[model samples]
Target chain A: MTLLKVEGLRSGYGEVQVLQGLDLTVDAGEIVVVLGANGAGKTTTLRALSGMIPAKGSVQFDGAEVIGRKPEDLVRRGIAHVPQGRGTFPELTVDENLQVGGFTQSAADTAADAERWYEVFPRLAERRDQLAGSMSGGEQQMLAIARALMSRPRLLLLDEPSLGLAPLITRDVFERITEVNQELGTTVLVVEQNANLALKIADRGYVLATGSIVASGTAEELSSDDSVRRAYLGV
Target chain B: MQLFVQRVFDGLQAGAIYAILALAIVIVFRASGMLNIAQGEIAMFTTFIAWNLFDVGLPWWASSVASLVIGFLVGAVLYRLLIVRLGGGHASPLAVVMVTIGLFLMLNDGAAVIWGTTAKPVPRIFGTGRVEIFGAGVAVQVLGLLAVLGVLVVVFGLLFQRTKLGLALRAVTSNQESAALAGIKVTTVLMIGWGLAGAIGSVAGSFTASGNFAVDRNMMQIVLIYAFAAATLGGFDSPLGAVLGGLIIGLVSELVVGYVAIVGPDLRLLPGFALVIIVLLVRPQGMFGSPKVVRA
Candidate 1:
């Protein structure tokens, strides 16, 4: 069930190192939430794993050395990263963004894949022809997740899905994440500042301070931990 | 009054040609995110190839067709071999612009050596004829211009709307990192975009030869400035806008020459470029460009 394993992952921009000797793993079908403060190397971890940044690390995804590989290669290998701030192709139609999600698939399979996601996210289907930029932020976030899922990835990396959504929308998004995990058996590696909500859905959690993991345990354990409650949950 | 109607038709024909070249410039700009000063030079060189073919006793149609295909090959190869290596490392748009200007000189000098500086005839693709309109005759040349423009519009529209390749090209233009993450090949899209622009430029150049009755070393240079103005009037990325902008510039340029006696025929591009600057001042993103919105 060990789908991804990382050891001593070191990465950064220029000489300012961010992720120094970081280690992490996600077994198959597990939702692992990585909770961290702002500028705590959480985003860098997702970028490095998706090969968006240069890094020195041992990242084995399904038994392949995925480190230093191109971004497209990671996508083709079934690792989808829904970047922070909803990096949807705003100029493209909502449907076209989904089509881009399934870009690597054959013509015969792309339509069926597109149809499944469209059904699952019917708000997207209703605005299929609308330009992505014109959509509401929450809708764009939904499209971003749907677009990522079009690749049918077994491992989905989400960065700050609740950053700007309203409280009601945030709750709906969190609920949808649970549904996606149950229905698709997709393993999710989520980085978020919303520790309370993230821990509610995640099986296990890792608490990162600065650029290192300060604590790690099951979500239930971390949720009850007094230090985690003070620092992250703010309870 | 009849003459005015005739002049309008003539202006539309000329506008259609300018639009093609404008579209080419916009395509190059949107893809590589650089303004290629050498666009006209590369286009001139390709038209010279068409001229050489025609001069060597090949049929006119055959030469023009062969030149377009050659232009596509050359543009694609140029990007793969030269342009791609520039890499975005410390390279500004101005730096790239200067390189293209250098390329312009190289191509111009290169063409002078290979084909000589003399003018050569590039025959019209459609044979000379006339169609009657309201008791007056319109040249087949005008119809030919409309026909070519129509085909280009349809093709480009389809390329933008229905195909995965178009989507990929757009992805690179919109966001390089996200496009790459989505499994879109950004580099390949860049090459294809350049090649398409080049091929269209060659067509415009050949039409230039046919319209002017001679092709020479400096053929594309004048047209290039006018094309820039047209692209500026339209949004930089809107192909349909480029054509529409071209038609307007051509007619207005003609009108400036025809109406105002003092600042006559010779100083045509001066006013045309001035118009573009004015248009840009009014709308930096151009007439059809979608405004960019950013989150706080």
Candidate 2:
């Protein structure tokens, strides 16, 4: 089942076009990674899909057109975007951060979701009362993911969740992402510059350059491709 | 010692007024990173409304409640009609600041036009009465204002600290984009924050009018300055800091006027402002402000 389908997606900041024409798809209950270097519009693609920016495209999510919707509107429709730079509410406590993520849910549901995420990320539960900003980079990343999960979205869009963390921490982050997909059966479309680790957990992957998808294949095939290795994996 | 106690009591009474006004300023500041220059004028205008209601035979407490509701509506309406178009967070700080200053003048002049330039007496809800504390005779006006401020603080504190709505507000205040991603209605929260500030200001205005025994066009001009100083001293973002800042400014103003021969009564306002400058110089983020930690 195709959870998301996009074609001819055009978006950019004012006077500078990025993601000129891009196409992508993600099946339900599968992890898909979009790999690209800086300025490759990987972030732009996620931003466009989340309705955080204006875009001219046809985005079919769960068989409904999702383009031209507000970010909040998109969240209600079961799409949650864990934005770049770990968009955690710094001043809010860890528990409060999760609570805000459940802004669209009922009070009882929010509490239950919080409890569920705490079981998945116990480090977060221990530091639940601490401010998000005061936490280390790795913990903040975990909190950001947990916060997004609070919405109980069918599709999760993660943009560079591994940015600015140690190699060990990055590996742990990937393990959690894999767990989120394998256990919950949540569809994921993650954009990453850390291609090697991202592709390790990805079922399918797309290589983005400049603004468009240059190549895409099953994770095993893309990981072995000579061109992809030289360009992104540095193998 | 008697004189000292009297001055301290006078300072606390004055501080109560500044504390509420500062809280009003802090609320708006937290929601929209702009200093609302019109806060004082808005309060003054609402106080005039209370006065008119009293003139029509409404009890003082009833009139105040009516004024607060009007204040809330006026604030929400103004944000939707005017401030929203001004581009809120995306707008230039200077442009936003200028718009508020413009509102300050317009609201002041508008009140004068509607109510006339003459002063009107605002009856105190708790009539003329006195209480003795520590050998100091205190008017019911002072005690009443303190009691009202206390209740307001506890109510607002609980609202902001314990409720889910408060969590949404804090999220919006900390990061607007993230709040939107969290499915919190950013614009609605901002509007409500402004409305609450206006309602709070109504109380401050009514209290000011009653304590001073009159409401006039320029009633809040000096009070606004004191409130601004208080907000700045308290770290414009911290509500607790605002209260402490107000009290500190009040005490400094009263003490300087009472004890400083060189400053004289005419220059008493100088000490409070001087304290602000000194504090800012020493601690740029104000007393209770979170030290900004930027990482690359």
Per-prediction DockQ scores? 0.56, 0.68
**In angstroms, what RMSD does candidate 2 have relative to the true structure?**
1.6
CAPRI verdict (incorrect, acceptable, medium, high) for model 1: medium
Residues B1-296 of candidate 2 have per-residue lDDT tens digits of 76788898789878878889999999988877778889988999998988889999998878888988988987877777778898755556678789889999999889878999899987776888878777877778788888888898898899999997788778888888888888988888888888989898888888888878888889888889999999999999998889889889999999989998898888978999999999999998889877744333
For model 2 chain A, give the 10-residue run with minimal summed lDDT: A226-235
Q: Candidate 2 at A128: error in angstroms?
A: 1.5
Residue B170 in model 2: lDDT = 87
Model 2 Cα displacement at A160 (Å)? 0.6
Q: Which one wins on TM-score?
A: 2
Supply the TM-score for candidate 1: 0.93
Off by over 4 Å in 2: A231-235, B293-296
Error of 2 at A192 (Å): 0.7
Model 2 DockQ class: medium
What's the TM for model 2? Answer: 0.96
Summarize candidate 1's per-residue lDDT along A99-167 as a digit string, tens digits.
888888887677898888788788998999988888888899898998888888989999999999998
Report the TM-score of candidate 2, chain A only: 0.98
